[model samples]
Target: MKHGRALTITITLLITVLFAVSAGCTGPVQQPSASPAVTAPAADGSSLVFTDQEFAFELRRTIGASYAGEADIGECLATASRIQEGDFESWYTEWNRTADAFRAAGDGSLAAGHRVSAMEAYYRAATYYRTAEFFLHGNPADPRIVETWSKSRDAFRDAIALDVVPYEIVAIPYENTTLPGYFYTVDDSGISRPLLIVQTGFDGCQEELHPYAMEGIRRGYNVLTFEGPGQGEVIRVQHIPFRADWENVIAPVVDYAAGRPDVDEDRIALWGISLGGYLAPRGAAYEPRITALVADGGTYDVGQNLLQNLQEGGGAPANLTEDDLQEWLQTDPAEFNDAILGAMAHDTGTRWLNENGMFVFSAASPAEFWAKWMEFSLAGIAEEIRCPTLVCAGAADHFDPDGVQAQALYDHLTCERDLMVFSDDYGAGSHCQLGAFAQSFAAKFDWLDDRMGMSG
Candidate 1:
């Protein structure tokens, strides 16, 4: 769900146009492929295609102790089996049902004075609820969207209340509103420690950042995971849209972190995941206070990658310039929305893409959404980053294969930088190394440890 590239309306329109042309000449039209053409092999040495790709990747994400337990796994797999591929309703129903079961179990445990059991169950329930709402992007007003997310948030709050480590709910002041966050430390040792400010990319919420926070805490780091503009509660509750000026978002977070006695002001690190690959670097470019930065599965230029995918998938003209595309994106909003809706009628991917993009970016139409995302590139600003940076990528990443964005980012950085590529042989070649989080975490945190000089 943490997507690095934009889902452009141009591609959807092109697909719709192409389908019409082909149908006119060749008789009845064929259905789009159920799965994406490019399939990545799973960590278990099996290739996952189409709808299975996302489900399998998510399963990998929750496999470790940072997210799920054995009971959670059983429930998730059972629910996954019951859901139909690319069917949003089925996906939501099954996961929500499992989450409800876990919620009940957690409540029972709490009533029986079993705090540990309650914590574990509540955490898993929160994760399940988050997953349930992942694909429900068609309607912002859908009561289920807010209801499921609220359940996830409340369950996470319950789990955090019982945490052995110190956990505090924080409200980081943004422009006019406060960003919601959770600050986690390994202990209340009253020692100033290296701090990690964690941000997730498109489609990820702060509740899903627990694994990264847990990893940092185990490595003697204080972690602050927050939902920024266009993410999680900020978007759902505050109605804030995504912005390209991530520095505005991060500067306030850094200000809040610096004020905390438990955080070492001199050793603060900023980490961004998925589309955050572009965001973290963009922030580090403007916010010089950050001592170190990490882009998990680095993304250099989201617009450029989107154009490439459009060319490949829709056979759009390859010679199109950004300016030219922008001009086309300035089409009448009504016309653009009509095209998007027409495309969405036939293509499931197009429907989800348009719905998700419109909701997150707060665009009135497809043209506005496409135009807004054009600024999400790190083309000219990557060189402005002045901190020790780590750029991570997976060799077979469908999102950024062969470290395309990571390598570009490393090449652009004028400061000390490291590029770590996860290989397919290690079963870590998917985006963000989904199936190999432990290995990815070890590599990422080890680099941070060396840079921050954390004593073992």
Candidate 2:
């Protein structure tokens, strides 16, 4: 696999890249609607035939190149592309080459650092594909999209498995079973190291592949990442479902980490995004070992956001009346579970799920979606966190209520916390801020410096 390993040296030699629940407050400029969560519109069947033609041009421009997506992205800019208006073939190609190189660089080599770099590229590629999909251009029910995504998932998993562990105990739980994660440590001889634990958002891998872990580590901390139930690896491989008891599961990881010889237990902080925004505060409620928590691009009510997506999905549920939420819990709970299962099965529909991944629904039907989501919302628990926290939201965040709910969470926290709405100046997208790569980590690293009072 190492020989076939396709790791991108650029991203590692180059880039690295979450936080709070309703630490609701204000951010900078954002997308127009209050909570216009992104959604993948069904592809333009008429124009899709042109995909072949588009691929012709794209293949010529990006083949064997590191920046495949650049071709399609450039076309959009050069021609003033509309929503769902550009080519994906060339874009997807660049994405694959970049990530494959990430893995190829570190694949089973004596140089262990590249292994982490490979995982970073692998993870970024997954995010890049999903982010591009959200803007539109595919058959929501298409099978080819599923095939393409499977390829990306395999690439990321390959990177994850190839790395060596620096820690003695690296456990990743999959329901009842626990698998050990690889370990890593900073070479610097700082006194006690700041222990950084990362909690990823929906469908995220716990390898610091996402931007959050990258940002945290770049700032100088011993960052540990692992997949929890219903997240990246857990769902994809173990098939162990997600449960509401997220904190209980994380407590064990924190406990294991705090006991490590390499870590300074006092500086432990947890950062997450999208749905993890909801899960992190809940986890903090029980495990206070975590000193700082960040709700990146805030979200107060996870369930409410899901409900809004259902309504926007043109499939408003029948039980959406005032007492609808209460009535549904008394009724069937998993009616719409298939909607998610179906979406996860197909890549074309992934953006639909990613845009609205963190919430649950009453049913998959047009009638019961909204009410069901509100039932699962975690808004009521924001008051439990007592750590010095930071809540951030890109002005154009897809989760609109992020600022509002983030402030609410901030007020509820018994500890000191801050809220920052990123300036429009940062063109970082809602959840997958590829553009803010270096800057995001720079901010997080600085934040850690402040908290640790490391100004020697």
Candidate 3:
């Protein structure tokens, strides 16, 4: 089966290359939006605190629900009020301060014998710590970045130790090392139970997966949330660079889960969020043991996005063929680096992308990083997915707006497939349905339950 899938992918790639050269055309790139100011409020009553709307939405979604409402909100508002637009230092300082306060509160609570309060406070502190480290990618070796992340991990460990359900911190052996993860189980029934493997996207960590894992737990499923290469402690501590071949990562993880006595190997499912949309499907294509797959905001060709951004920035030609594009990417790196730096100087989004991309991809220059990102795609491999698959996207997801990638992947899938587009009418039309987690989870777990033979 693997050999057949490989052959299919090779043929598909050949045909795609032929089509690309014959067509001699590429889609026009949309113009880049103006650098908007991160102000307190707009006339519409929306807070313009974060330069990125998606970031703002995600922050709001997690704060009250995942963190302490009063302290986190107050800290957030105060920070936003003073944050200089696109200033990573300012952002880190405020969030880090808030995290410190939360950690102190958790310690006090625990000392007072308020276990539940301590657990909640510790969880909130961990999230705050993660938030602080989000934009500090300019220097991967920065001591503060490592310190903050360590604090986050410690807080999460403390929280889970006091959790109602059993939460086990695990170290799944990979190629030369191990990946960190948390296993959430309702009980030690000794009977095998359905399992869900949760993979976070570009900026997400294992700690942030608690909400999603809890949802799966309530549905009687054991959940494992792990951070692979280029994510969380794996990237920070072990310095494992990101790779496009996610099958290598998932296969090892699946091996670990299959060996566990509590996991029902036949009912194992994989769920990927944000950028994991692309990673999960790519893994499912090669790792055929997975029974079901869910991509929360699907992606088909990651290169298309990079090309679009490049074209919008007037760095690439609209009609550039694949061969021509590849040659162009190999050109003088210094010039490309300068262009990226200039763009980052004015655009907050561009700045974040440049810094984060270089760190995760371990590329010396922006051009190389972009070139590497182009490798992560499901164009030819989507058809190899044999398991029941669910592709989800928000109607207004700026990351994959119009659900183009999800739609494309769904159309190409050879197995039983489902695509659910959360709409703005229900306040779910944001990236990852951030403001509508319940609706998104309902759609995901419902589809998963039916496919996994679980009755609600």
For all candidates, what are the clash counts? 1, 47, 0
Overall lDDT per candidate, in order of appearance: 0.73, 0.47, 0.71
Instruction: Mark the regions of model 3 whose C-alpha exceeds 4 Å error after superposition.
Output: 1-48, 51-58, 64-75, 308-319
lDDT (Cα, tens digit) per residue for candidate 3, span 234-292: 88888887898999999999999999999999899999988888888889999978999
Tens-digit lDDT track for model 2 on 182-300? 34455445446886777765544453343344344545567777767666445445545455657877787787777777788877877766566666767876787978876664556
Where does the lowest 10-residue lDDT sum fall in candidate 2?
Answer: 9-18
Kindly provide the TM-score of model 1 when superposed on the true structure, using C-alpha atoms. Answer: 0.86
Alpha-carbon shift of residue 283 in model 2 (angstroms): 0.3
After TM-score superposition, the amount by which residue 185's alpha carbon in candidate 1 deviates from its true location, in angstroms, is 1.6
After TM-score superposition, the amount by which residue 417's alpha carbon in candidate 1 deviates from its true location, in angstroms, is 1.5
Which portions of model 1 show Cα errors greater than 4 Å?
1-52, 62-71, 309-319, 332-349
Candidates sorted on TM-score, descending:
1, 3, 2
User: Which candidate would rank higher by lDDT, 1 or 3?
Assistant: 1
Q: List the residue pairs that clash in candidate 1.
A: 35-50
lDDT string, candidate 1, 175-223, tens digits: 9889999999889886888898899887789888887898889888999
RMSD in order of candidates: 8.7, 12.5, 9.1
Best by lDDT: 1
